[model samples]
Target: MWYLNDDLVDSSYHAENENQVINHISVPNIQRSQHRANLECRARNTVLISPVSKTVSIELNLRPLSVSILQRHSQLSTHTQYEITCESWGSHPPPTLLWFLEGQELKGVTTEESRSSNTSVSRLLFTPTPEFDGKRLICRASNPLLPGTAIEDFWQLRVVYSPILSLRLGSSINPNAIKFQDDVYYECVIRANPPAVKLTWYHNGENLKHTPTSGIIMSNQSLALQKVTRASAGIYVCSATNNEGEGRSNPVELKVMYAPTCRNDLSSAEGTPVIIAASRSEDVNITCEMDALPESLRFHWAHTNTVGEAVDLEPEIYTSQGSKSFLFYNLRSEEDFGTLLCWAQNSIGTAERPCIYQIVPAVDISNYKQYPNYGIKHSFSSSPQFPRHG
Candidate 1:
């Protein structure tokens, strides 16, 4: 007797000898249950001779596991539904479909069987979020035909979102006050899943023109302000836009700090010289003062004598606090004795004041008569002070 998977196989049972009988059946399919049957023979004489059936198992180790992504979700935008489809190719017994997210199996995905072909497609639908950006999605194909293994393919998601703009002050100017001619920088940083498409700048609600650099039109990121002036102060805003939408930053105030313009309304603008007589051929100090805003004023002196040509005088090597007029220390009768000109300057502008300067002649030494005494004291002085009678 023979059996195939516990079923009787008596058609090929025949007598091979007087006491031995054999059965042969060609296995058309070598399946897993092929070797699980028993082949046994029994003879009936005076008594029955029977043998126990032997168990066998067939191992058909043919692995046909292959999967691929036929079509995937094209809409890679955040807050939108995304869909993906994958198929199992050249697999026997129709491989099962599975889904994985971050190495973990996901449930609720169903496999679709093809009515015309032996193919099976697995589809997964999900709504993407910000956390799902750049996440990997997997489609797995597994079957009992492969025994204990599965094949999988993966896709990385690209989520697109609008740009969120943030404005910052770069290391060029402060918000309080900016100096004239100083460089200023305004940065418009964009935060988004996908990079921004364009950026724009506005001043006082008017769109500013785009600046070009290296053949590329630059808009966002950073803006350079060169040679800033008083007019550069204004309300500035930045806008950034992406495929999803646009974003803008709050307005920032840009104020420019500069010296005030030199004016002619000074109480001391009347060109009058403050004269110090130079006796004994020494130096003399003169004055021409002006009142100006932005008190960090600069002073310049110029003089022309009777013989020497007009020349610029070097300023004294010291700072004059709360006073605008500086002096020319050394003066000679033949060199620096004529009209002197003074100019006051600030960052805004410069103003000149002309004044008449004269050198008072020194008295002859013969006028100083010495008294007849042991110490030889002078009888006359240049500035005489009489004894106080009161």
Candidate 2:
């Protein structure tokens, strides 16, 4: 005779009514699962029932959420600790917040939520190094309602660091073979977080001024020599600087190419007919050099004996970087004693230098009294009588 939720109440759900046809059912809480429940009333006469009377529908909705990162500094110092905070605002079912660096998920995160606004904030602690400069970080918020889908925000990190520079000569000519009139170029390669603002060039510890019209093409990153000479050859240094700090590179040597020149000063002692005093069996090495340029050269050694006779003797000659060196090994004090002349010739021209080998014998001075006129007399009939530094 009575029904609760379209089910016949077996005298338990019966309520006191005047016609004894009313029943009641109590559900403590009606949730989404219990939505659209029907209730009816019927007169029990040979299994007779009435149509369902009432039904209800329940509607559920959640708030919208957004994820964002808090901007603290535009340029952060490298190798320094920083707190990156991400926030998810106003979400129902509590949107999950996560931190990502360049699409990679991060761990060890701490999250807190606002009780009234339903906003969750997550903080990630990080220390950025120089290798991590110019990278991007991200924060994401995902709802449980929408699985596998998330909203993300990103920030490109500009971590500041000192400049690292490497200066190198950009040229096709070999340094040892560089010749006069050959063009040369130099460039500075730099890497930094904020990047180097400027670069400077120096030659032999002196700053090189720009002389564009004078064939010296000097720029911030490049130093070009259109026409190289002996004055243009030196150690070139490059320096780079930024707001963070400055950096210096290893100096590069630029040698101008030309014909060979005798370096008699480095041979033995300095003189016009460069007088080289040496004892018998002493190592006598003569050398000459030009501003190293790429060119083949011929070396010839001629020795003028004490008898005023010139004979071409085989001298040990070593050539390198526009310079040539000759070594005299095991002189006999009498046979190797002579006026030595070295001639160097290239495609450009030829240059000559002279040397007088005074081979003194290692003998007892008291023996000179026993042997009168035992040594050859010093004479320069054709050469200069008075020696001067070359």
Candidate 3:
């Protein structure tokens, strides 16, 4: 029998009658890392050989089994089910498994485990809640192979949550161009973390004034902009940062329209005889008074049948707002008596009106000779304009 380091570790071998009795044993290494406190090793003779029995113990500075944890929970919640796997392996026997929160042991929880002929493994489960925030959780694995001999290892665990972020727009603005004097607003919203999340708003790569409000509403993440201007027309970004890391929202491009208080210098009034010649087979000159911020405006015209669909004229005429003349060279009979529509769209809205035109076959000039007293040639060169229908 022998004792090492004031009984920190011990060993013993007893033989009777020198009959080659078996009696050899070894003490494994035990180490502690920021958790465990002590390690002990001991050996004793289990059998009394005819006359004598002996035992020994030793105090060895061996390293304990290393313990680690693998978490399978992606999102944490008060009622969210999750799994935790704890594993510890060392050259020790009959290890102990323990769970802790804030350095306090959890009680009365059933534990399942497997041993590597000398190691220990355990799995535990629990629902995460807000109360778990800022608290340290740990798992310990210990081995007690011999009487009064034990070793242990431990691991730390952490929990995290997911966040939500979104953008809000007041009105739709044209991406191509903006006029002036238009009001635009941008809003950002998000669901804050348990400990809370810091949110920031940026416009056109620059931070918004008075941004980073500590808390706006119950939601930890939300932002808004008012009366958008040309400066507001740019990529907007929202970022949420916390101890866990950072989450950013999808970039949103803002377009601010220009709506000047004054009107453009263009007009289409009654008694204005604008001649429209066919520029192409499907061309039409459109004339209208437009108060466009771009100063002057052009109009486009199109002919549509009774079906409210477009039809062909002798010359196709496509006119936009502010244009006074259009040409149509290809006139299809199927498009006769169809309506012509003129529309102008700007940052505000679309200005559109329709006019009807009828196509008729040529008639003899003698049909209008009822009131002619002086001698005149009967020809189709001159014809009276058709009267408007009520």
Candidate 4:
């Protein structure tokens, strides 16, 4: 008779022609609960004396029934420390536990096991960086006795971080070749864990607003400047904001090329003439100042009379320094009295309007009468005449 843990084996078979009758019994559906069970075989010739019995203890090797990771937050912040635990049950000698990241084994992990309960546990201390986001983190369990049997619990990592920003000129623009009245733009490149919600632009430390009508068109990631002028030349920066934090880019400088223009204080209204009174045979000095990017200005002086006759002034009569020019004229005769036009030119182009000056004869003070404690009033029979040249 064969018995496995007090259960009768009805299908016991006997081998023929053996010195001692050999009985074979099969234990079906072995499980972890059957480990250390007793198996017994007994032989009785006359059913009277105590049966000779042979007993053996069964030790079963089983794979883990379940392996899982404890519930925890899926989202993690960069540079923060966290603890993750994994558990396995129903292995005979307790399964070997380990941690893995992106298919590579992780060292320095802590593990605990209980032989009485057939359970194994592993704990991993983790710290994540921005580069670790979207990678797989795994907790694997396997038994050394059972080859090629491994179970794992894995999840993709989500790491939160602040925004990173970079500011650049448009792809089609050349930093060294920008010019006035040219169309240009800037681009803001960003990288962030969470998408950026707001983007801001700055010029020379002042915040810039979106005003399309003024040639400043702004979008989420770019700024377009139409017909750029000298005033548009300055330092520019871009910034991005998200839930994590804000990030700012390095400053980019813009240089614009432009022609010379009259200085604001020296400029005159259109068609308004500046009058100069001087006597004949006297030398008068006229100065013209201009504003330009390159500051290398070329000046041209011309005289146009009331009779429509025009003559270019000799270069020897004028001196130029930087963006300013001075002309000396001697009114030796009436022909020298006329309209003086000062024209300035630079690398870009010439000024749109020339500075105009009218040369007129000075008033005679001897003909006016002065009274005590009263202002003088002069009465002349003839009006002043404008000079004519042929």
Candidate 5:
């Protein structure tokens, strides 16, 4: 008869030319609770005399049944520290535990074992960075006696990070060659966790608003600039906001090119022609200034009578320097008393409108009252004539 843990073994065979019987016992689905169980073999004839028995204890080397992370956190923040624990059960001599992030081994992990409970626990101290978002964190348990048998549990990290933004020019537009009245646009690309909730645009350090009537249209991630002018050339920026924080992009400068135009600041009566009073046969120096890109400018002067007759003035009477032109004119007769126009040209094109000056006869100041020596008498000849120079 054979018994294991007080259970009889059903199969036995006699050894040839030996005074002994060999018994075979099969146990299925052994559990960790059954480790070190006693197994006994005994010999008896008809229940007579005491049975001769041999006993032994069962020993087993087992791989861990499962591995899991304990004290798990739902969220992790950048620049903050957090501690996590992992535990494994049902491994003989306690399983070796380790931590990993995105397939890379993690250091400074502390591991402890419980012989009574057949459990292994490991603790990991971690500090998350913005770049660590969405990475995989793993807890692995392996038995030293069992090679190639490792169990693991993993978590997808949900790290909270500030928004990332980039502002770019719209496709199909050349940044270096933007011209006046050209339609332009910009795009804002964003990368963030928890997604972006708001977006803003800026120009020249001032926040911009959506003003469609003024040709500035804006959306959550884009801006459309209709009919851009020289005023539109400036530094532009984009920003995005999320639950974590706000982030701003680097500045992008827009340069607009255009032809010559009259400088409004230097003009009197705005765009209307300026009136100059001068005497006949008097020499006058008229100056014309313009604003344009590429600075270099070519100027032309012309004269027109009230009857609409016009003639281009000779270039020898005018000298141009950069964006300004100086014209020396001799108003010798009534024919020179009409309108004088100045036009400028650059690489872009000719000026859309010329700077105009209306030449009229000066008010007569030929006679003045004289008092003692305190005031000096001033007078002009009835027929004033000044020498003319080519």
Candidate 6:
């Protein structure tokens, strides 16, 4: 008798036991099933009283397809980003997993080893365009146990971005009330997400369809408009949008200005009467009045017909805080007859006043001039010498 793996085989009555020899037992193509099947075999001599049985056990293997996205649905603006990942769960020589985008194999994928497991995962990160919206992406797991068989999952891609509507004119430039035909400039700005903002202009709260001097530009978080116009005035508003959301700017007002135009007339004063004898001293005075904001006054005098001689005056230059006058001492000749000119100038322009003077024959002489005429008094005790021309 002989035993193979705890099973017995016997040959007794029969001359040859080759016909009763047991060879092999097995469960081929094992797979997860509702019930398990046991494998057994027996070998015996032709006339042996009992036959012996040998047994073996087999277990089924299974794997499941996995689902994950490089990320959850995210916002993308023109030239913005989106990504996805495809991975699975399996054992005994990890199964092969494949990635697909919009039902097509992912063109670019980066792979890394699992840190805690014996599995490999792949990633496909990319920026999606407007053309990528409403597309389908699929992930699958492939294994040899089920040849040409695979588990699958899918996701839908979305594209979201904001669009620019209109621009708002700020109140900083135009305050109070704006006048018509006034040259003016204003600024308009708006803020939004998902970039690529476009700005438009308006007049009197109406959309501007004509030539516009300003343009809209996009910054990190805001939009700008420069050098706006009076026609660009009114309740201005700006709107910005993206796949995420939209925003608007508060209203603004504008005003303009022009040059001031005004006119005025000057009034004169009656002249005072005064006389001066030839070869004698005399004093003269003139007055002027002007009209201007933050008032001012000025005085001037000049001979009209004098021949290269200024009337001898004690104080040639006379000055007061708001007025001026002229004086002469010991006049010697009669060439001083012309006119004394007094001019007053202000912001508006210049005005003038004049005085006329005539020279009369000398009569009363000054003490200095009389001294030469008086005869020398006789000496106290001697005869006074007669005055001589020398």
**Top model by lDDT, which number?**
5
TM-score of 2: 0.54
Question: What is the C-alpha lDDT profile of model 1 across 5-100, one tens digit per residue?
Answer: 566655556788988766665667565434324544333444356454554544343344578876666548765675678888645566778887
Candidate ranking (TM-score, best to worst): 5, 2, 4, 1, 6, 3
Cα lDDT computed for each candidate against the true fold: 0.61, 0.64, 0.46, 0.79, 0.81, 0.44
lDDT per residue as tens, model 2, 1-390: 344465665444454776555655454555533334454444443445644444433333344358889965787886478888888875656678888778678888898888576688899888776765667788888877867667889888878887877878785657776667778888878887677887777889998778888778877688888878878888998887888788788888887756665453444444434334445555556554432244466666677766778877664343433355444444555767657666667765665444334333333223323433232222222322322112
Candidate 3 residues 159-220, lDDT tens each? Answer: 56544457665346444454344444445665545443577777667765563242212233
lDDT score at residue 80, model 4, on the 0-100 scale: 75
Cand. 5 Cα-lDDT: 0.81
Question: For residues 1-390, what per-residue lDDT tens digits would candidate 5 score against the true structure?
Answer: 556688875547576656756766677888766688887878776566898888888889888999999876788987578889999998886898988898899999898888778888899998888777888899999988999889899999889877888888988889977888999999999988879898999999999999999999997699999999988999999998898889998789998888998874343434566555567777778888899886799999999976788999999999999999999988777888788899999888899889887666655222211211111111223555422211
Q: Could you tell me which residue pairs clash in candidate 4?
A: none
List the candidates' TM-scores in order.
0.37, 0.54, 0.30, 0.53, 0.56, 0.31
lDDT of 2 at 357: 41
Model 4 alpha-carbon drift over 4 Å, by segment: 1-159, 204-206, 264-271, 306-308, 364-390
> Considering only N, C-alpha and C atoms within 3 Å, which residue pairs clash in candidate 5?
none
Model 4, position 220, has a per-residue lDDT of 72
Q: Which stretches of candidate 3 lie over 4 Å from their true place?
A: 1-119, 122-157, 160-164, 168-187, 190-198, 211-222, 229-231, 243-245, 255-343, 350-390
Tens digits of per-residue lDDT for model 6, 1-390: 333334444322333465544353333454544113344455455664777655545334445445454555654554555456666654324566667766678677766656365455667777765555667767666666767557777777666544534343334534543343433443544334445454544445665443334443434333334443333344655454555566555555443321111111221123321222333233333232333222344444455435555443223554423323333322334554433334444443444333333233333313223334222111111222222211
For residue 390, give model 3's deviation from the true position in Å: 50
Total backbone collisions for each predicted model:
1, 9, 60, 0, 0, 12
